[model samples]
Target: MSTPKPGKIAAQFMAHKREMRLSPAWKALRGNDKLVLERIEEEHMAHGGSTDSLPVTFTDFQEWGVRRAAIAESIARVEALGFVECVERGRPSRAEHRFPAKYRLTYAHGPKVRVTDDWRKVVDAEDAQRRIDEALAELQARTAALSGKLKKSAKQRAEDRALQARNAA
Candidate 1:
């Protein structure tokens, strides 16, 4: 038996059948979500077909034509649908401390790993939509709460500065 070429292997892995294309989780993916998935797959392929710990940064997605604002949500949506899982959550801290998130495509198997088709759990379109909607809503709520807290802290700091100035005078 002969080993398949890299291109042939990648094409086979990336290709989906018509039935899979029509599946609820697959069909529910938006353009950005699909782009995010593709970008991750590209990264995986670049790393010699390693499925886990594939680092796909926001900038990478942006270069692939995904909007900056949509990148996080797209990642979340794909994750919610079980197409990928974040193994390490990246933090946007100081440049020295910054790290891109690492991901694993659930459907792709590595030498020692087995495929986990988590998307198969999604029963229908409505179920897939509901899962994505719920995850996004929760994310929005957390973002809003954090914004509120930040605003409160800023206001407190301003008041402290004003009081200090009055006392100095």
Candidate 2:
């Protein structure tokens, strides 16, 4: 599969938008399923993810005030229609313990067409990057707190020592 540049990715995303608008599978989706898919698409675009894959979190759907189980069912319905798929399971950070599954979607998944290799690569790359970014962000957050604790200024250190000495006296 070729590594598509940013421009090519944008073009592909536009094509996907066109295809999604006209796709029979998308049309067949129920109202809730359609809403979920649309939100996923919006998030994919917002995050610069490939048109074929989206990183969707439960929190992303939280704005709709929907139940988690209902959202899962909606996703299942979309997947059953071949309108979307969960490409990767999310790994949550220990601190926040929030993880959202990654999804892939395309008009090619319509009954009439097959997902091409190039599109698959785009989806895969987007999912991988999402995972990497999540891991890095978690690591940075964790280390940031630790680093702050380790870097005490001389005055702060002196103050702490003086307090300890006073307590002992």
> Best candidate per TM-score, number?
1
Q: Positional deviation of 91 in candidate 2, in angstroms?
A: 6.6
Largest lDDT belongs to which candidate? 1
**Lowest summed-lDDT stretch of 10 residues in model 1?**
9-18
TM-score of each: 0.79, 0.46
Please give the TM-score that candidate 2 achieves against the real structure. 0.46
Compared with the true structure, what per-residue lDDT tens digits does model 2 show for residues 53-169? Answer: 567887677665546656765766566555566788665556756666877764433333346423232234345345335544665686587668667665689999999999999
Weakest ten-residue segment in model 2 by summed lDDT: 116-125
Model 1 C-alpha RMSD vs. true structure (Å) is 3.7
Residue pairs with clashing backbones, model 2: none
Model 1 error, position 122 (Å): 0.8
Off by over 4 Å in 2: 1-24, 49-53, 65-67, 91-94, 108-169
What tens-digit string does per-residue lDDT give for candidate 1 at 101-141?
A: 99988876557444677888889988999999988997789
Go through the candidates in order and give the C-alpha RMSD of each one to the true structure: 3.7, 14.4
In candidate 2 the C-alpha lDDT for residue 144 amounts to 84
**Cα-based lDDT at residue 123, candidate 2:** 35
Our tally of clashes for model 2 stands at: 0
